[model samples]
Target: MSRITFEDLEALDDDDFTEDNSEPMDEEEQDRLFSHWQSVASTHQVSIPAEMAGPIQQMTRQSNAREPVPFATLSRHEKLDEVVYEERMYPAGKWACVTKGEELYEQSISMAFMKLMRYICKENSAGRYLGMTVPVLNEIQISKDGKSFVRDILTAYYLPAEFQQDPPEPLDPDIVIVQREPVRVVTRVFFGTTTEETISRQISSLWELLESTEDFLRDTYIVAVYENPGIPCRRNEIWFIRRDQ
Candidate 1:
């Protein structure tokens, strides 16, 4: 819904290796330099040059592990937990996420996954590379038609501890940085692939359990996937945001 303006293009420095001819950049070098910026722009659905595909793939591999947000499990339900998420101020940083999706769970999840991965491959406005982090969060909601729809899928990579003072702006519009205040939540962990029936069942169970409790109140819920897809056994959790007492 947003247009890439001349100023926007200008802001993203063009890869001009041919200008000086001081040894052309090789595949690895090209990826190190321009791939991040190209991927960032692409997250916003902006058109990029064909030559960058190779570098983009290279960037995907660079996405490894980073520091994750810390929390403590207050109570355990098999593999799941009622977590007391540590009260910490989430530093301002760009989170690559998609706000729309299809009605089906798998289809919608796949689309959101691609968008977030594209954001990871791209560089932010500051030209700094962000390391990938785990537990991609997907917020889901049920529609009036009695069908499940993904409200928004969020893949947030934590900015390094140093970026606490000032984080770089996202080059792409879809990747926006905002501060998150601390909150409490009840979470139910599960494994294997998530299906529509599974989601419905889980939502019902978490709500029922919460309603019986005296203190906890549900404002909303989020679906958190911790492992990469294709992993035969992946960890997933449904998080119910608890209202302030």
Candidate 2:
């Protein structure tokens, strides 16, 4: 029989795998499979590459169960038969934000997330556990070429209501407290894992639905991810700040 390599496994479509039709593996079974793969690689004197290791890691990782920052739904309207966007009013609140400069949106957000996570996890001047919040907001500035992102990609975590009045100051210089003003945004929601390509497509779809109107700012937009990387069918959104507000 021909050896089924790691690349071969990666190349297989969802329908090609028997496990696709099977029930989701429990934690114990996931652990067993993880260990089994490690043992196989060890016995063969080979190492698992990152592409393969990532999915393996994700399979065993826990999802973020934090509460989302509160917002008031001002109104909702159907832009398309399949797409319903909303107008939301987010009250003035405090947010812990980090700015990262990287070409890739994923890479920049990943780095900034760690810093903001540390701030909430008690790496602050007050040494208080601030807890976590969902739908991390990433504000992206597209490059001049319009094909890639610029240096300043700001990632922010909304401070929970309890800490909105007096949030702990971050010890890390890169992490700053942003006092956001009450503003209204028109947002469109989508599902699945987010990437640069996916984000662009969503934004373009939103733009077309909005008819490239002057109602919202077009210079930059906000990308919000409500779930952690481990979660499947994750909720994501594209937010355009209304110019009238």
**What TM-score against the true fold does each predicted structure earn?**
0.59, 0.71
Tens digits of per-residue lDDT for model 1, 1-245: 23444344445433332122334457886654454444334434444456545334444344344456555555554425454222222233434455545545555565555555555555565564555566676766655565555454444444555564576666556666656555466777676556667766777777665535544533345777875442334578777765562
What digit string (tens of lDDT, one per residue) describes model 2 on residues 1-245?
Answer: 12344443334342211132225666676655455445334322333443343344332232333567888998887635654788898888888899987656666776677577567666787786565677799998777777766767899999887888888888889998999888788899998645678888988888887755888876778998875443334589999898867
Name the lDDT of candidate 1: 0.53
Candidate number of the best lDDT: 2
Output the number of the TM-score-best candidate.
2
Q: Which pairs of residues clash in candidate 1, taking residues 3 or more apart in a chain or in different chains?
A: 36-123, 40-122
* lDDT value for model 2: 0.68
Off by over 4 Å in 2: 1-65, 79-83, 144-147
**Which ten residues in a row are the worst by lDDT in model 1?**
84-93
